[model samples]
Target chain A: MVQIPNTPAPTKSPAPRPVPTSADVARLAGVSRATVSYVLNNTSAVRISEPTRRRVHEAAKELGYVPHAAARTLRAGHSRMVLMPTLPVPAGPLYSQFVHDFQGALSRLDYTVVQYGATGLRGDDAARAWAELRPVAVLVPSPGIGPEGVAVLKRSGARAVVTLSPVAVEGARALLLDHADVGQSAAAHLYARGRRRIGVVVPEEPGMEVFSAPRLAGAREAVHGTDATVTELSLAYTEESAAALAARWRGLGLDAVFAYNDEYAMLLMRALQDEGLRIPEDVAVIGADDLMLGRLLRPRLSTVRIALPSGRDLASLVDRAVRNPAAAPESQERFVATVVHRDSS
Target chain B: MVQIPNTPAPTKSPAPRPVPTSADVARLAGVSRATVSYVLNNTSAVRISEPTRRRVHEAAKELGYVPHAAARTLRAGHSRMVLMPTLPVPAGPLYSQFVHDFQGALSRLDYTVVQYGATGLRGDDAARAWAELRPVAVLVPSPGIGPEGVAVLKRSGARAVVTLSPVAVEGARALLLDHADVGQSAAAHLYARGRRRIGVVVPEEPGMEVFSAPRLAGAREAVHGTDATVTELSLAYTEESAAALAARWRGLGLDAVFAYNDEYAMLLMRALQDEGLRIPEDVAVIGADDLMLGRLLRPRLSTVRIALPSGRDLASLVDRAVRNPAAAPESQERFVATVVHRDSS
Candidate 1:
């Protein structure tokens, strides 16, 4: 074994107390180490007396003994960990809600959900980093994980490799949520409402290109072979950026706009209103994600409501994939986008 | 040795490809495993030739070899993981922004930030679950982590136990962000505006009680020894709930309301407006966490501007604690809340 130099001492306690082990718990409880393991790990396969279990639990509590997950993984050869690499951008309420539901569902399925912040890493580098943890499954919510990354993860003992991407990734189960549909639906709605000079708000925030690029492409596709002209308007999430965009709005001469999402749309709409632009009369506005705050606005913002797959369903899919890693990778297009018409358009 | 039965096979690969190890990379690169480890782990103490390093890296990439984090921890006796238990509730923009920034800062400091979903676990149980991962540090953003929990984490090799709570937790470094201050600032601002009957919005959402209860107490504290009376208004985040509350607003006979935060304020404000109740004229409204969308509202929402500690500053504190675990626990009151008077109030 290669000696690892400069390994920091694990415990920095002034009088470092030895970590209580199962053997200590067993000695305290007057039971065998196997009995302590069965009790502490809650091995349902073996039945231990209730009083004996209580004794083991009491001893563990008294000694502050908790099983090390890493040690357990090393021994068991697998862990019930579902690694979700955290995206770089701040998750909006819509995304947060989905994550919350997904986590709850995954928890119910007895999987420990872990969100690892792999900020600077991408593709194979990121996959390698995640593989080091030896997670049973990896649910990547971004587009950077290529086929090579999927292969690396599978080779490193990942039972399931799932990706929420615009297109199917080789050797991975795809939770295809095409963002382009959101832009298409919004653009079509505006065009149907007699809007010809169309502008699309592309958020200038870094790491938003994965979603915004596809949405922009969809908007261009919707306006193809039509008199409607599509213009790209770059706007940041800040109020100042919205104001600056609104200040030069008249020069762009766009009659309608499909802001990337509700948050950006709300920012731009308020700026345009401050600039004496009436809602649909001056410039029609539409956004995607259909956030609740959008409906609270004065014009009752029009939006393309995106329906994501139920968290429970996704959890079940993951569970099934984990049970049968050899099963053919499933590609399901569960994303549905429909225009929710309100007063704005 | 205690036998662990029912241990699942590590990999379910159809053709079961063996996981490439440092030894495999060394063999392929015609070098010692120590050389490969030094090059891969970037151990600066031992220098290897550039050509040898390139060969080792190329072999690692070709064989998809990744050093096991668990194995490394076993050898080093510690890890560079900072565990943050994921909160039960969906994070709002303000909280999400803070997490994003904190994760980025921690990443720059070479700490792997991991958000573990300990949904059903609480207090000591939650700490035990986190300690099982053997994280170097535990940053609890919410309450429920007690002295016992701190002890449990520290005993399991956590060098730093940091908490963002209203009060300092025993035996843990405190990032004191009192939620009550937010409510007090808003209530004081409204009371100063000559509004006597104050209504404090308490969100009905589960897991929000930790924040809402403290804020409610603070509002009541602000109104103490005065004619102003504080009433608890339980409201969910949904627009339907806001509309239902707004429908019976006149019956409550409240002169002003301190909505939970800017999101709740905006939601309730729109509902009240829809009910033909002019803001500030009929009932002055104030909220906390001065969100940007609050400024975009027609009445320009008056809010308690909450200034949280810089992510970099918090990261530095965590790093300091990790480096010097025996140092006295630090308690810093970095949360500052001040009311921003706007057109709404």
Candidate 2:
């Protein structure tokens, strides 16, 4: 074992006095502890006169009383929470932006968003770990967990389990978002633009197989369905990787490339330009996830636009499911994907 | 008084008994309640041997013993948590990505990240509202909360307060990252590329002034130090805003624009291209936060590379502060900014 260096001792004293409790507020308001609880929680049942409610509110205000989240969770069974398990991915711009929007939308509905860190866990273990907190719902982005995992979560009282994967689980509601559609849509648009040869970007990341495989499959599906021939190109999301890919662009003889998304498209586009390849004239490029900056390019890059199901819709579904655990599973919904054509394609 | 309509009630009976608690785990493990708590919490004072620990762990695992969060909070006196109060402005891709990374880093150190819904609170009131939970720290984005707010939190037992503002609060350790530096760095690079009449993007969203103001200030500061002048152009993230801004590109007579970041830069770039503007020649564009897709543009976008302090460094600092609250306030640390030159500029 490595010997640890001695650290300086801390000098700070313990904080002054304990935090004021709801009992203090109840005493000050001259009401039963239950009455204070009901007034403070704004519960609809067990009516108190307006003035009495005002008295409890005033006492709470004077004492700086905020309901304890932990105590509330204990009484309420589960938190008014939605947990999204996050993995570190090279999300680039568009996907990152969508996540930001999703968070803001969830906040508007008074639901707390908890991003559970599940870095090393996989499958049923990951699901069981997540279910430990008793979240109302779990939104898994390309879930590594399977049917057994879903069963574990359901048994633990997770009302709704939504995965952004094409494959549906036995016990959970699946949001079957076909990533293949994004890749297919990009390829189809490029093919229609009269490009015979296409390069599909394959990200060189271990976990991206979850996203990249489906996208590649979709691109191949589109290419095989048409006269266009598709070539797979493995590229890591790095300056060096993009430069190397650009250096070999001439040898590949591809007329156009679907660079996965706006980030990869921009990366390769710059490298190709550095290699003296004029976009559209020498090569046409398309990206997916119509990011905000795609249009800012010299020749605006064409991209695939994916619309997420509205936050209101998802939140309402979660609320309903939590209230009635035996309710029938909601039908799987697939969000629409469309193409936004610009100059590069 | 408005009469409320009766809602359809649940048709099926509720599930048997509540989620198994710590008491249940104790019974399953055939251990005393104190022994179970000691093993589960890994309390060092208790000399429970390895076999005893294993037995307790297995029993808790078999019974699915998730500590009731509320009960734990009540017993612990304070939460093992941090609260981040977000403004109404959408946390675009770059900031959102940083936040995600920050959360990951914090989780590694055993801190639970809670994004509080602070929309209805402001200033000192926001601090009071957050203090109700007795979190260990509060991280407010730059320009979101003020000094009085920080003081309120300190009085409420928040040991550490971190903010992204240029100004440091009296008691909090400020991670002073200047947003203006981002725009100035981008503008300086654009000017070096012989582009004149720079356009600075100003987001039209109600709450974006916090970010946009600093960026514009930085751009103007750089331009004022030279012969060029920055034209502040208001653009929202919406398509309509981009189209309108793009349509009047020629009227502004700007040869280059410093977009706030990759997202807005991409939005305006697309709009400009749609309106038939030649990138670099007609209107060179530069964005901040060197996103992966910037290079994928027809002419790669030049950007300001913001060098944020490592998450490990920040977390370690926070932990130290928590352990020693009376330690002299850490001197404000400022991160450096540099320009990443690409084809667009």
Number of colliding residue pairs in each model: 0, 16
Q: What is the interface RMSD of each candidate, in Å?
A: 1.5, 3.7
User: Model 2, range A146-190, lDDT digits (tens) per residue?
Assistant: 887776676556777877777777767778878888888888888
RMSD of each: 5.6, 4.8
lDDT of all the models against the reference? 0.90, 0.75
Tens digits of per-residue lDDT, candidate 1, A160-181, equal 9999989899999998989988
Error of 2 at B186 (Å): 6.0
Q: Chain B alone: TM-score in each candidate? A: 0.93, 0.85
Model 2 chain A lDDT-worst window of ten:
A90-99
